[model samples]
Target: MSPGGKSAKSSSPSPPANYSAAGEEFIGVDDFNEDAHTPESKTGSAYLEIHSRQNNAILKKNQEESIETINYLEIQSFELLNT
Candidate 1:
């Protein structure tokens, strides 16, 4: 450390307040592209294929369970209202 109370290391220039990693500036509404954020098929195929049946079944089961839970809650609420 220098006796002058300042570090001797060279400092890099700081980015501007509006600087963004996405680009030079933050994305604006006019610059927003809905399709740009959508996933693209690197394989050049339009269809997405799931190679794992076990994973697919697990996801499906979870979805079905969620739907069943929602339905049960709705029924309970209805029954309470009728009471």
Candidate 2:
């Protein structure tokens, strides 16, 4: 028996390969309506922005704290060496 359980000379038709391309256009808030005012929508948008800002601040604080800890360790090592 061959590797595929058939003779090596057995001919089999191969299927054609397929390909596709797709994309989408993003629409901003200003593109939707002229006067469809709603308080909830505005509040939600503002809340998201505030949340993003807070997250960025927390990340920055953590990074600064890490640097400070590393500096403190270096100073203590230097003091130990002098003694």
Candidate 3:
């Protein structure tokens, strides 16, 4: 083996960035709506920003779970070989 060690032969495909948890795609609008007066009625980019944050949160959770699962499997494999 080289000093850098061996790299894996297979890699998992990355999740799509545009997809949401509920499979909803964001369609943004061009208008900022200056005459709306109040902020509650006119949501120019809030929805998109919130949805993007939600997607990021879910992805972080999944990544954490994947690490835990990988560690568990490695321990089980070692036990099996020892037995």
Choose the strongest candidate by lDDT.
Answer: 3
Model 3 backbone overlap count: 0
Q: How accurate is candidate 1 locally (lDDT)?
A: 0.56
lDDT of 1 by residue, 1-83 (tens): 88899878767665443443344753332233333322232331222234356679999999999999999999999999999
Q: What is the lDDT of residue 48 in candidate 1?
A: 28
Off by over 4 Å in 3: 1-44
Rank the models by TM-score, top first: 3, 2, 1
Return the TM-score for each candidate structure. 0.37, 0.42, 0.48
Candidate 2 residue lDDT tens string, 11-81 = 65432222111223223434322243222356546755787899999999999999999999999999999
Best by TM-score: 3
- Name model 1 segments beyond 4 Å from true: 1-51
Candidate 2 has a TM-score of: 0.42
Give the clash total for candidate 1.
Answer: 0
Clashes of each: 0, 0, 0
